[model samples]
Each structure stands twice: as structure tokens, then as C-alpha cells.
Target: MNTQSLTKKWSKTICLAFLYSLSIFSNCYSKGNRIQSSDLKDSLISLLKKSGNDTLMIDSVYAHIRINRRRLGEEYKNTLLEYIDYTTKIQYSRGAMRMYDRLGLNERYDERYDSAVYYHLKSLELALELKDSFQMAYNYNNIGQAYRLQDINNLAIKNFHKALELQEANGNDKGASFTQNTLGAVYVVQKEYDQAMHYFRESQKIAVRRKDQRTQSYNLGAIGEVFLLRDQPDSAIVYFNTAKDIKQQMGDKKGLAVSKHLVGQAYFKKGNYVEAQKFLNEALVIHQKYNNERYIALCFDYLGKVKLKQNQFSEAGAYLLKAKEIASNIHSYENLISINNSLKEYYQEMDKWPMAMLAIQQNQQINDSLFSLKKTREMQALEIEYETEKQEQQIKLLSAENEIKEQRLKIGIAIITLLVLTIAFGIFIQKEKQKRFVLERDKVKQQLLRSQMNPHFLFNALGSIQSYMYQNDVKTAARYMGNFASLTRSILNNSAVEQVSLEEEISTLTNYLELEKMRLQSNFQYSIKVPEEMDIEFITVPPMLIQPFVENAIKHGIKNYTSGGKVELTFEETSDLIHVIIEDNGEGIDTTRGKMVSSHKSMATSIFKQRMKIIRDKFPNVPEPVIADLSDVNRKGTRIDLYLPILELTSTSNA
Candidate 1:
């Protein structure tokens, strides 16, 4: 049967679950039990009245809601909100945390990532204040999952690792398994299949040991996704079917629907159109019953593709349009992109060139919007990171201040013991204070230099945006603006930290180059190359360290070049240092002149030299940066080699 027919026939699963719960309550009430109520809210109110101010009873209610939160969904949101207020009135921290966490999960189910993260963070704060490590870990996992859903993989992975560490430390194997599974899912989105498989297998091992059927089913489905991505439909189907059977037996209707969808995808890949359509329709029916527009849209899209493969153009068009309508209604750009691509194919097959063009245009616009959305999410992630780092710094500062106060108090007491001893202690304290003052001055100086560099970077980027805007090129201007936001996000994010992964540094450089490329109207081309064997994520480097040199290379070496200007960046690592080479095939620096051509170049060079001097003095063993003039070598380019210390990031540092 088709998806539409199946959807029409399927009854509401949530209603059924509610009815089942009601039946249990009815049965208990008929036996003259105290648990007599017309609905869950009534029973909750009765329980509250009986419990009075008992914290344990309130906690139990919170626990009950958590256990059945999936079944409850938004059905008990108002009840939970009311309970949260009551918990707050009674100062029940644990109950409030659990309630907020459940509300976060419900928001997550509805794809309200911002609300989900907000609630999860609220729960995390309570967990921290209460010193509840398990709750902290659970909330971290939830927050990570919310970020993961929005494709903010970096922040998601960071939160997942945080949760994993706490879970493993607390010996909460089930929580650890869940976190590991989520980590695998994020890796799956990132297309790191081998890494994904590793986590999945590890999670599966724990789930199996604990006899966690739900987690086992999740693992199976995740493993199937890896196989599907690898184009091993035959293998994928086996795993998907196994997961589906488990979910069915476990009465996880939502999970079963997801598995059926995966099964349909495997069948589609295996060229079994009939089987694919059947499974997709079945999944679509469940999705419709649950009112899951995202999955319903996905089911329709896949069904449309299946029909397209079978030469059923009319059926394909119908399914694809239905998918598009639902996707558009929900503003699911990613799904709309897929649906449009399929519709483009359908239009082409039917020889409707204009319709095909329209579909392509729609996809392009959707892709642009997706890019903007991605940048917005990245900005949100960066803001969260910055806030977290700021809080940590403030905590450290407070601790240091407290320690200093305690030291002074001890010194005062020690002074009463002996005058001579006091003199010696006074001298020692003076030296320590002087040392701290010097350290603080250096830190402030470094921060000043960084602050200077950021404004310079921002001004250059703003100039590029302004240039496009002047030309009445709205499309290019918008694209450039999006890239600018992305670059600004990276800068603001890295500005909070002293060091960042080489991968991040490279990404920032790429964003800068993209903006420059657009601004220069493709007058210059650039390439950044790193060795394939390099583990960029494991290697930490100074944040925004290379951008100034690249900026110099672009503005001085290539800006006025007539044609074929190119800038190349290459990375090489020795045992002790990372060698970053920036080479530009343009006019080399003219040393014969009395001074540099631009004040910006002079300041950039001076600031870079000072930063390098600071690094050298701090780490005496590190090599200094080198600049070579290609003009002297009879080449029309400048080459700079930056020898940075190879700092390895520990697992803890990633958090």
C-alpha cells in the first residue's frame, strides 16, 4: 500500500498509549484502590495533596514522568510546568532538575533545539549545584543530542565527551553506553564511518552486558546506517531488520518506525522497489500516527525516489510533491533539498525543462538558506562555548583571589610568631606579588595584541562585504555576508581560547580565503594543503596565528596583481615543530624602499614580531618565524615559513 493509503488507515498511537494507561487506572480504581483518577493530571494532583511537603513523594512523581516521558510527550507539559513551580516553591532541587530535563527531552522530540538546550543547561546548572554527577552526565548527553540534531557537530562532540567522562567515572555503564551511541551517531553524520563503528560496537558491548534491549536496538540501527552509507544494502537490511524486530518486541513504536524507514532505504538501494515502498508506507503510517512531519516527509521522499526508479513518473511526482509540501510547511530545508532534487529528476524525465529549472533554482535558494542557518547555529554554538569558557575563567579567578586572601591571613598570623620571621616572609610575599603582577601585565599585553588583530580582521572583512553591496550584486553580497558571519563566528569563538586545533585554524583560514576570493571577484585563487597523515584535530596551535601573514600575502603580494595571482599555504611537521609555509605568486616585498608600502603592513609585521618574541621567551626551545624575499631569488612571490611548537591536545583538553 502507498503512504497516503497507509496514513489514512493508521490510528493514533499516542491515543492508544493513553487509553492503555487509563485502562490500568480503571482496573485499580474498580478494586477500591486509592489510585483513582479520570486522568494523569488528576492523579498527580491527588498525589500532591496527599504528599503535602514531602520531597521524596515529589521526586517520585518526577521520576515517574521521566520513565514514561516518551509516551507522555507534550501531553503532560502543562502538568510538568505546574509541578516545576511547586517544586521551586518547596525548594526541591532534584525534582526541579528532573522536570526540566524531561521538558528538554520533549522539546528535543519536537526539534526545538534552542529550547531543548536551554532546558538541558538549566538542569545541568542544578545538577552542578547539587553535586549530582549522574544528573550532570545525563543533561550533558541531552544537550549534546540537541546540538547534534542541528548539525553543530563540534560542540555536540564536546558535550558528548563530557557526558561520557562523567558517566564512566561514576560507573554508570548504561549512561555511558547511551552517550557512546550518541557520539557514534554524530560521527555518522560527519561521515567518519570507521570511527562511528568503533563507538557503536563499544556501546553495543555494554548494552548487551546490561541486557538493555532499547540501547541494543539503537546500536543495531546505527550499525545499519554505517552499512547503508557504505552501500552494503544487503548487510544493512540484516541489521535494520534485527533492530526493527527488537523495537517491535520492546513496544517502542517510534523506534520501530525509524527501523522500518531504514529497512525501506536498504530495499531501495537493493533495487527492490515493491519492498521499499511497502516498508516506507508502513513507516509513514506510524510517523503520521505520531504526527512526526519530518519522518513523514522523509518517507514520502524515499517512496518518491523508489517510484522514480520504477519508471512510474506520475506516482513519483505525486509523492515528491507531497513530501515537498510537508517539508516546506515544517521549514525542513534539508528534506526540501532532497525532495526538490528528486522533483528535478522527475521534471527532466517528463521533458518539462522550465519546471526542472524552477526546481533547481528552488534547491539553490534552499541551499543558500541552509548555509545561513548553519552559520547561525555555529554562532550559537560559539556563543555557548564563549560563555562556558568565561564562566570557567571567572571561577578560576575567584579561586585565585580566595587563595591569595587565605595566604595573607596566614601571613598575618605568622607575623605574630616572630618579627624576624615576619621580615623574611614579607620579602617572599613581595617577590610572589611582583611575579604575579608581571604575569598579569604580560597577559594583558597579549590580550591587547589579540584585540588589535581582531578589529583589523573585522575591518578587512567588512570592506569585502561593502564592496559587493556597492555593485548591486545582491546574490554575491548575501553569499559573502554568510561567509563573513561564518568567519566572524570562528574568530569570536577562537578569541576565547589561547590555542585551537589545527583543523579549526585551517577552517578559519579557508573561510578568510573564501571571503577574499569573493571580494576580489576571483582575481586571485588560494589553496591550503596539509599532509594526509596529519592528525589536525589532535594538534593544537595558536588561535588565528596564521591569518595575519595570509592577509599580508593577499593585500600586499596579490591585491594589485594583473592576472593569475595565487596564494598557497602548506603544512609540514617535524618532531618538535609545525612548519606552515605561506607562499604568494605576486609582487614580492621591495626591500630597496626606505619603508613598507602600507601602514597596515608595518603594524601587522610589528605585532607579529612582538607575538613571536613573547612565544619564544615563554618557550625558549621554540624556533622563530622566518620570512624569505623571493624578489632576491628572481621569483615574483614572497614565502614565509612559520615554525610553531607542536602542541598535542590531551583528551581532557578537548573538553
Candidate 2:
């Protein structure tokens, strides 16, 4: 049988068997008195074994877990994980696929999109191996959901369309309905409201026909949002009320809260502050109960607006302040913008011109940040497209080569010498191509290293200069700006070079440290020492290799110290290698502060390690870099020793 036919056959068989098994399991559970979770788990395991490890019996158990997943609390994820382990042990691909899909759903609920996508892709691979169209569509839909959360709209739409196509081909109305709803959401985010409503209506029709109340409710709310965006508050409220009624009937507190919030927004836009406040307060209570920070902030923002309209300035200020705090803490840039705008309005109403000006300035800064972020996403999208095109071209080249090989085979001995020549030329071309590829790859890696130099450093350095300028200390500001300019120039120049003279590297480090010290208001002192015997001009080291460690030392270690912070760098040359030792006199790497340092520190460390590995691989005589925490030896700081092979001019030419 064909794959599609086989999928259909198995799906039908599994559905029937699953239903029968579910009925038996439900009946047994219903007949019993209250049973502990341990007893229930043991009974399920016994039944699983008794059924000869049947996949259908496993599905029934998964179904029960999923149905009561919310009630299972924090243990629900663990239960699914255990089921996955059991299914894998039995070599049950279908059960494992389902369990993986469930785990992805759990991750998605937790807002962990990367983990969700990983699990969904795992499920997709297994589904493909099994040729199971149902599971394939399910996983595709889920992967799309994860991508959508990450705002990767193009990939999300592609996966959603794939799932929709599969669902339609398989006559799975339920799956198609869900995919339609998802596509509508993507369009809504893109601000294509008409297209969004079209898909939402399609989904609503199918969901209503299928008696899928949950999906129908979601569609109603989504359509209401489109109306709200169109400024038709009355129409929006009508749909919102319908969604709210459905959610209430289904006892979906979260959905009900969202609908209530939307209804409040509609009323607020219509200038009905009393009704808006009532609905918003109701939504706030539910959101708080659910611990939904984003929604809680939204509630506070709307409440603030309501109070402002009521002329309750004190209450308005308090609500707006709370919302701003939450939005800033969560790094919700869009929400922060909204809160700033509200603050601007609040201050304007109170005739606080300075406060209003500050609010406007902050809002402008946030807008710039949002614009930068959007451009970054667009650039990433372009990179993805470029990679896809590159792969397509590669495939085309391979296909042409295969065709040429076939033609050569047809000619036989008549073209044997020509074939040999062609093969030799091909090998030469391949070798040159690989050389160019490696050069380009290395160039890109170097550029990435330059780009990773923290942009925040530049911003703060400029801010320090600006502060000095504001204080009318032109001399101080000029000195700071000169240092900043020199450091940036040195970095840009070094980024293009494979290695730099030790003297030049030391000069760059001195300039960088001077600027940082000024930025930190002399909170830390730094010293660089070079051995008298070492030839600083002759010896060469990798550009920017040691700077990141010093930067980390200053930022994570010394900066955290209240006073008397110090960072020292010493360079020593051995017979075969140069050792650059960086030591910091500050509180050691505390486990409590590890999380804060892990992000940027880990990235820089990982990049440095990878670069060192590449160098060691190229020159096997080089030793690996070593890093040590002196706290392990009853000391109180971090010490990193970088082992770099010294490159002379002739050695560089040889390389």
C-alpha cells in the first residue's frame, strides 16, 4: 500500500482500538473508590504490561494524562516524560511520537519556544519514519506555533500551510480548523486584519460544525480583536461577549480573562470608563490568580487610563507606576512604550513639564530600540533566505554534475581521455572552491567576534561623556571621548587582522581599560605588565583574544565589588608559548551570581575556546588555554591563563 493509504489504515485501526481501550480504562477507574496517584500509576503500568505492551493501550494512558493535565499540576510534565521513556524502552515509535508532541505542548505553554521547537521536530522526524500523516500534521502545526511565538512569521506560515495541506488531504477537519486559526493569528500579527478575519471565519465555521467549542471561542475572540483594531468598538464587544459566554460555559478561566480584558478595552475606547473599569478589574483578579504577568501589566495599564480619565491623578500615577515596573522587569519593549506614553500623558495633565519631557525622551529611546530590533529581525530573515537559496543552488549543481556523469558513461571509451581530463579539472576546481569557502568562513567568524564586542559598552561610554558635558566639564568629556575614539579605532583595525604585535595589543588594552575606568567612575583599577625580556614588537598574538577576559573580569567581578576593586594582567613568554595571565581582586564567582554572568561571559568564553581549538588543531604543538578560579585554593578571585603560540614574521608567512 502507498504511504497515505497505509497511514489511513493504521489511523482508523488505532482510533477504534484506542476508543475501546479508553472505555475499558474509564470504566475501571469509575468503578473504584478514590485512589492515590501511586496506586493509579501502578495500575496503569500493570495494565500496560498486561496488554502485551500494545501501542493502543499506551495511547489510552496518554489520553487520560492529557485530559487531566491541568489538574495534575507541576507533575504533568514529569508524567509525560516518564511515558516517553517507557514508550522508547518498548520501541514504540507511535507512542513515543505522541509523548514527544505532548512534551512540546508543555514547553510551549511555558513560553520556552526553543525547547518546544526541538521536541516538535523530534516528533516530526519520528512521524516521517512511520509515514504517519496524522502525527506529521500535528507536529507541523505545533512547530509552527513555536515559531510564531518567536515572531518568525515566514517559517511559521510555511509550516502552518504544510499542516493545513496535510490535514485537508487527509480529511481531518479538526486539524484543518486548528491550522486555520493559527494562520489567522499570524496574519493578525502582521496587521492584515481582513485576511485574518477571513481565516478566522473559516475556522469558526468548521469548529462550529464539528462542535469544537474551545476553538470556536478562540475564533470569536480573534475576530473581535480584528473589529477592535478597526475601531468598531460595538462590533468588537458583541463578539467579545460571545467568546466570554463560551469560555464561561467551558470553565476556561484563562480564556475568560482574555475576553474580559478585550471587552474592557472596547468599552474604554468607547469612553465608557465605568464599564471598562468593571471588566478590567474582573480580568485583573483572574490574571493575578493565574500569575500571568503580561496580562497583569495590561490590566494595570488599562486601569491607569481609566483612572486618568476619571481625574483621579494619584490613583492613575500608582497604577501606571506598577504597570511600568512590571513591563520594564519583563523587558517587554512594546509594553514599556505604552507605559511611557501613558506617563507622558499623566505628567502633561498634571502640568509637570520636566517629568513629561523625561517621559517623552524615554519613549523616544524605546522607539529607537524597537526599530533596531525590527531591523535585526529583518536582517536575520534575509540571512535565512540566503542560506536557503545557497542550498538550492548546491542541489542544482549536484544534479547537473550527475547528468554530466551519465552522459560521460554513455560515450564510453570514445571520451575516456576527455573524461579523465574533466575529472582532474573538477578535482582542482573543488580544491580551490574549498579554500575560498574556508577563507570566507574565517572572515565571517572574525566579523562575528568584532560584532560581539558589547554594544552596551559604547552606549555607556557615550552616556558618561554626555554626563560630563552636562556638568560643564568639557575637558573631562573631551578626554573621555578621545579615549573612546582611540579604543574603537584600535578594535576596528585589529578585527581585520589575524594577529597583532604584542605592543599594539597592550596599547589597545590600555586604551580600553582607561575608558572603562572613566565610565565606571574609577570603581576599579587595572594594571598591565609585560616582562622586560619579551620582545613586544616581534612577538604576535591573536587579535582581541585576551580583551574579552579582561572585560568579563571588570564587568562581572570587579564591578560587583563595593570598593577597592582591582584587575591585573601580566604577560610571560615561555620557550614555546606566551602566557597572558588575567587576575581580578574581587568577590569570587558566587553560585548566586553565576546566572547573571552566564549569558555574556559564556558566549565570549565559548567563542574564545572554539578559536583556541581551531588554532590547536591547525598547529598541534600549541597547548590548550587554561582558566582557574583561585577561590578553589582558598583565594578570592578568578585567574585565566591564555596560552598563545608566538608568531614571528617568517612563521606567519609559513602559516
Candidate 3:
């Protein structure tokens, strides 16, 4: 939303497009002259004037009225919507106009342009229907403010003129003067300094006469703006200071801050470097305290100018970039364009050719887009007017028939399509469920097989140790046999369930690796290292998770190495996730055969996928494990990295 839009929104009530409201229009509902009574109406209407009944209440009330009144037909709905439409016209309900005007004003200040327009336009419709001059003026003013924020100054001017007419009609000379001051603001944006001052001065006179301190401050600040634009720093300072004093006297902190900031700007405009910094820094704090990003960006922009003048290129660039980014985010075209143009000049002065040219290009593009949107909006507005007139004619002839025909056609097609889609979707879901059932049954059977095979493998290893002992070669096979016992117990313990602690899983790997090392005779050395800080016991990873990867590296990679062959397993935690890297310094990979051997591609990758699929069935939200090789760089090695999020499920929860 534009500042102009905000201004229009508030101004609508003040200018009398909307009136200060007091009444809650009761809803009357009927079907064929038999009426419907609702119980919620009295309780809701009693809240109408309550302090906090803002936009939400307003919308709720509108909905309630529409529903309880059963105002569905064109005539009944139009009666209610007619009240809505009048806010945009010349008439208004006196109290209703004021409510909309205040709403518009608040929304404008809060940067809620769309909301402001909605309320102001609603006020406008009511004002028009009631022929209430006060409210009509308010709505016009608010609408104009909205147009102003939109950068549609022509429409803003037109609506402002309409507001002025209504203000005069209502004998609100003071209000008329206020609208004129805003008109001056529009001119200031247009760079028509002289005309801006003329309207501003006229507004100031009325404020001074009426003893309206707030308006007086606004007028003073506005005049200061015109002087600043004209490069008359001294005059701008005088007006800004005057505005500050009045705003302070009125206890308007926001107004005071705005005026003081402008005074700082005037000093910057005058090229008094010392004076400029002094005021601008103060202005920056004030704006920050107020949380006003728009004015804050403005202050920074001026500060950047000062920095550029001092040849503080780095500082200047920082301030400019900050201002440019904020202005772009807020959609403040006027400020953005000005800052960008200034930055182009500064960058060029510093011989930063690329940045300077880019700034120039962006500035042009922004303005072009703004202009194009303005023209498109105008075309649409014209089309709407034409359609509205056509619609009125359409209402008198075949309107009921047309509506019934369109509604029935749409309803019947929608029902049939929805039914067909529902049936198809049901079929798809049922088929998926059946497939999952079959897969689950197969998975349970396989789980039993893997569990049984691990114990049998442990028995074979143990029997080998016993044979060695019988031959009186105890020392030779003692370690392998002990490892086999530990491995068997761990496998039997965890194999009955789906998951085990990372500590248990790693221990299983250690036992298996010990047995492998005894058999392989250190042809390729291997090591396991896990960071102490990693919560191994807390991580409930799958059982036998690391077994297959070890099998792959040793059988495939180390088998091809002649010398200096090694495999290193490391587990660490980073960024709240567990990271595991399995690497080997061996003949990394082979492509000699017509196809990849089982050692490299089959057991680890395919079985790992099955395990992952089962894990996903239980933990569907967790991401799949990452698998990648870090071998190419060394060429003498292969490295595989696995990433798993730090899912610390308790042993009990793992079930």
C-alpha cells in the first residue's frame, strides 16, 4: 500500500466521505414474506460501540446481517450492498462515514491500504445513499488518499476535488483546508514546489485560525518539504522547526519525530557536512525508536549522500545499499527512485562503473513498471464502469432466468465431476492400501530370515574358534571367538526389534570388523572412530546398519589394492545432525567387468534401500539417508558419506 493510499483512507472520514457512526441497523430476513429470526443479533449489536470492535467485528457483523436477513436475491442483497456502494459516491450516512474515515485513517497509518480502501469505499457508499454531506466528504478524502498512495495522482486529484466540494457543501472549511494540504503533498511528489506551497499555505492559514494544533503541525511540515525540494535549506529548516514545536505542544510524538527528521534532512540538503551528520544521526535514532522503516530509509539515504561527499566510499555504499533494499521491500517508489539515482551518481564518482550502470538501469525499470501499472489500472477502471452500466440494464431483462440457468448448470456439473473424482480417488487409495499390505507381509517374513541368519553366522564363527582351541592354538583364535560371541548376543538382542541404539549398532560393527581383521591378516587396515560428543546411545538407528557398507569396502575396494590399503570409519555430529563417513585408501572402484560386482553395488545399496523403506513406513516425515562417494579426488581411495538427522528417539519410543 502507498502512503497516498493511507492518507486517502484516513482522510475519507475526516473529509466526511464517512461519518462518525452510532447506529446498528437491525437485520430483517424473510422468504415469501415469512421472516427468519436470529438469536445472535441483539448480543452482537450491543457490541457495536465497544472500544475494540474494529475490522474483525465489522466483517462479522456484515456476515451476520447477510445471513440472518436471508438477503440472497439481487434486490435484497442490492439493498444491503447499496449501502456499501454509497461510500464511493457523493452521499454518506453521517455517523457511518466517520467510522469508515477513522478506519481508513488507521489503516493508512498502519500501511494497510487494501483494508483502508475497503472501509473508505464502504463509507462512501453509505454517504451517497444517505446524502450526508459530512460523510460524503470524508469518503472522498479517504479514497483520494488511497489513490495518492497508488501513485495515481490524477485520480487522487480528482477525488480530492470531490472531497473539497462536499466539505464546502457541509460548511467544513477547516476540513476543506486539510484536504488542500494533502493536495499540496501530491504536487510535491509531482515536483511542483510552487503549487505545493500555495495549497500548503492555504491549509496552514485554516489550521492557525481554528487553533487546530495537529493540522497546523502537518501544514508546517508539508511546507518545509516543499522548501527542501526547492533546495532552500534555510527556509526548510525554519518551517520544520516550527512544525516540531507545534507537534510537541500537541503531544503528538509521531508528528514531532517526523518534523525533527525533516529538519535533519534540510541540514543535509544545505551541504553543511558537520551540521548534516549531527541532525541525520539524531533523526535515525528517532525513526528507529518509532520503528518507521520508510523515514529511516530516508535518513540513511541522506546519510549516504553525506558519506559520498566525504569520499567515505565504503560507508557510503553500505548506507546506500541498506536504503535501496528497504525502499524496494516497502515498495516506496518515490524514495527508491531518488536513492537509486543518487547512488548511480555516487558509484560513478568512485569509478564503480558496473554498479553505477546497474543502478541506472534498475531505476528506469522501476519507474517504467510503476507507469505501466498505472495505465493498466486506468484501463480496467474504465472497463468496470462500462460493465457496471451493462449490468444495470441486464438486471431488468432476463436477470432471474440468466442467474438460475448459470447456477443450475454450474451446480450440476460440479456435483457430477466431484462424484466421479471421488470414486477414482477412492479406487486409487484402495489399490495403494492393498499393495502396502502385501509389502508389509513380505517385509515381516524377511525380517525373520535376516534375524535367523545372523545367529547361524555367529555359530559358524564360534565353531571355528572351538576347532582352533581343540588344536591347542587358543591364542591364535581367542579374539575372533570372543568377538563372535559379542556379535551374536547383540544381533539376537536387537534383531527381534526394528531399531537399536547407535552404541549397540557400532559395537556390533566393531565385533564384526574384529572377526574380519583376524581372517584378513591386515592386508587392508580398518579403524572405527566416533566423536565422544555425538550422542551414540540416544540415536536409535536401524540394527545392523553399518554391516553392509563394511562388507562392500573390504570385499570390493581392499581386495584390489596391492599396498597402503586402509578403511576409516568416522561418526560425528554437526548442525544438529549425525554425519558418518566411511572411506578407504584402496583400488577405489573397478569397471573392467561387463557389470558391477555384487560387492560394490548389490548388498549395501539394495538392502539399505529396503531398510530405509521400512523406516519411512514408520517415520514418514524424516528425509532419506544421503549416500555419496568422496573417492575421485584421491583416486587411490573411496569415501562414502551418510547423513542422518539427529532423531533421538528413546529406546522405548523406537518401538
lDDT of 2 by residue, 3-85 (tens): 66754554454344444434533443353323345544554555455545765446645644644454456667777777887
Model 2 worst lDDT window (10 residues) = 439-448
Give the per-residue lDDT of model 3 (tens digit) for 1-655.
7766654544443223112111111121122323223223333343332314244334333433332333233233333443344322423245345556555655675677667766776666554555455565667677778767766676677778877766655556656777888888888877888888888888877667755566677788888887787789999999899889876655556677787668877887787887878777877887898789999888888888889888887898899899988898899888998899879978898889999999889989988998899798777556543553463354332222343455567779999998997787987677575334221000001111143344445566656665665565545554454344334333322333555456655655665665665566556666788865344645555555556667677777688655456778898754334567887766565433422234445544576677767756644533554333345464565666665544434211000
For model 1, the superposed segments whose C-alpha errors exceed 4 Å read: 1-126, 251-254, 281-292, 393-655
Deviation from native of the Cα of residue 384 in model 1, angstroms? 1.4
What lDDT, from 0 to 1, does candidate 2 have? 0.72
User: How far off is residue 408 in model 2, in Å?
Assistant: 42
Regions of model 2 farther than 4 Å from truth: 1-96, 99-115, 289-291, 381-655
How high is the lDDT of residue 553 in model 1? 87
